[model samples]
Target: MTTTHEISADCKACGSCVEICPNRILQKDAAGKVFFRPDRLWMCFRCGQCMSICPSRAVMIPGLSYETDFYPQPALDERAFDAFETLAANRRAGRSFQDRPVPRELLEKLVEVIALAPPSFPPVKTELTVVADPALMHRSLGLMIDLYDNLVKKMANPVARFFIRRQAGRETFITLNNHVIPLLKERLPDLKSGKEDTLTRRAPAMILFHSDRQSENYRTDIAIAMTYAILAAPALGLAGTIIDLIPPAVEKSPALRALFQIPAGSEVVGAVILGFPKRRFLRGIRRPLKSVTWL
Candidate 1:
């Protein structure tokens, strides 16, 4: 499937589509009717702005339907900003979860939000896998713990450390050495002894966001989708947290590959565990970025 747009005779000559096109491929003729430039056709990334803003529904993009894709947008209340601020301010990393599994309906709602996430490109290249079964999640958690334990052990060897650093790059090796290794070393005994779970936090459900390794901007695409899911969770009566360890572990483990049905040459870019939160915070914490500069 490739991108193509068609303008119908019903075009109202409003000039809205021409102005809205990102690539400026849509133009106005001397008659003020909107037409696509043939030479500039290659620049059209199919963002659908023209079709979306057309009042007469005259603009059509392949794989999209005016009737189905466009809906009556509801007006936001004056308090909408307050509501959004409250939602954003209250979001916290949910590390502990209740024993029960997250409802399928709620998970589907998160998926819907994920669907709305803007792709880095016109067609979304990312994929999501929901592990909703409690037993399956538990098994996956065990595998991840095992994988990290092995990683800690492997990083302890000079030869292994040297090879890993060379292969994974300096920044990646620094992250593993300074952050991941210490955290795993401290948690591995407890993790194996069933004392506590610092990994998935025993959440009853998890979603893996992944894509083909060769896909352009797949990492950012998956990150955006995962962010949408986590942000949408509290509204659906669920808690969510992004787990950084899962993706790397998934990439390395043949067992995890089979479990998640991750195809060859694809990468798991992000993962998040979701469930009813084990506890609630009385107050939200303030976390500002280290630096901000205005140009």
Candidate 2:
């Protein structure tokens, strides 16, 4: 008796398995597609090399192995591109947040979407800290503001002062020993309605993305995850703004680091304050793209 197997037509003919087969048992058919000859099956150690290298994801080894099914493909669609363009056109600093709370279930869903983001390697190694308490959110914002005030008073350069003052409201410095109050104040007006403070608008949830300091892909991995959250927020009828005020505060205060339970070797690369957007953009704008080539 003999057994025969079928090669999936969906195979992209990448030849990845052919290159890696130790026994050279896999061969390309006349159409340059990979196929396993009956004689070569005996030589197969069942190393699963063919299953691993098939880029089309059409390979299956039946009882040999199983892979966890991934959901909600993380790749962005055309609508996402349009949203990105809208963000670029407005060029408005997301200064204020709303007081609306994000439901825990929705937050979990957002995390699920983030989980789909492409990691640096096969096994993703990123961690998330979600803070939903209003008191803590305010405390974190206050800490950043206080640090910003102290740094500004210490700065002596006039140009630096002007630059800081000019962009004051738009930037959020989450690093240690940097003053972020002026920037917060400058952007506050855009976010404020009447006497109400719109910036730090008191969202129901905040998510902090952290990475191991020694991990080669720490920064890149965290960044991609954060981007996933940003894109998915709008779809969920939620809005988020990345805060840069935490890393600096964490760097300066051991107590703060302990409060957030940040490990000694890890750093907070980014933070996103999440909630429903109080203001929405209804139109798109345009700007000139600039480029220079030295050839």
Candidate 3:
């Protein structure tokens, strides 16, 4: 456990550290020196809010487990809000993509911005890895398809289906029979022709977000971070969609995890496939909410 964070000699005693501490662990003594209750160290969120809000760069938090070198900028004005709203309205889930690859620098910039995804709990950090190589992307998708194909094959056996249905429940059969198999069969001709990988959308790039799954808020953190990344994509001249299929497959198979080079104890919670869209949308569509409440 990192026990001590520093307050430098340059401290202006502005009390920002005391005010912004999420855990309320920092305090100012009668001498106006910032100090902390050592017993409350366990509650520190390590959010670096104190260091950020300080007018003097004196509160040096070396004891925190995360990054603190970042500086905030003013990005939320009316014009910025309107621009974001337009971006949100125009956002599309780009199923089909152009053949061109995303530039490395641009993709890196998107990853940097999306790294701002918030941690819902103490220390669950979401990591983003971009699979920008077309060859590697196709091979990885092929490996996932192989897993599904093997599953589809095994489920074809009466004995295997009997055991699987008993062990995994009826939804496995329902998903395979109704959804998975039909879609695969429908794309058979396309698969044979090598015209496309209908499943992956064969996007020029893929982003995989991996995180520890022990916490109850794990999935929520993943969702929030992924949502932020998705909303931020259109502005970066890219398009993406939330991929629900691959994560389940990865969760079920260690081989799939190894194929993507995910960390040993971590799991893939969010996957986004990004690329330039092949076609442009003429207008934004609407989806009205069903219900609301006021008290």
Predicted structure with the largest lDDT when compared to the true one: 1
lDDT of 3: 0.77
The window of 10 residues in a row where model 3 has the poorest summed lDDT is 62-71
lDDT of 3 by residue, 1-295 (tens): 1356777788888898899898888889889898876778678777778777877777766555334455565667669878978989978898988998989987888877776777776465786667888877777776677777776677678998788778767877687778876777677457546676776788888888887655557777888878877888888888988887777677778776776788877878888989988898998889888977778
Looking at model 1, which ten-residue stretch has the lowest summed lDDT?
A: 1-10
Give TM per candidate.
0.95, 0.60, 0.85
CA lDDT, every model vs. true structure: 0.87, 0.66, 0.77
Of the two candidates 2 and 3, the one with more favorable TM-score, higher being better, is: 3
- Residue 15 accuracy (lDDT) in model 3: 95
Residue-level lDDT tens digits of model 2 in 189-223: 44333244343456667888887787778778888
Q: Over the full model, what C-alpha lDDT does candidate 1 score relative to the true structure?
A: 0.87
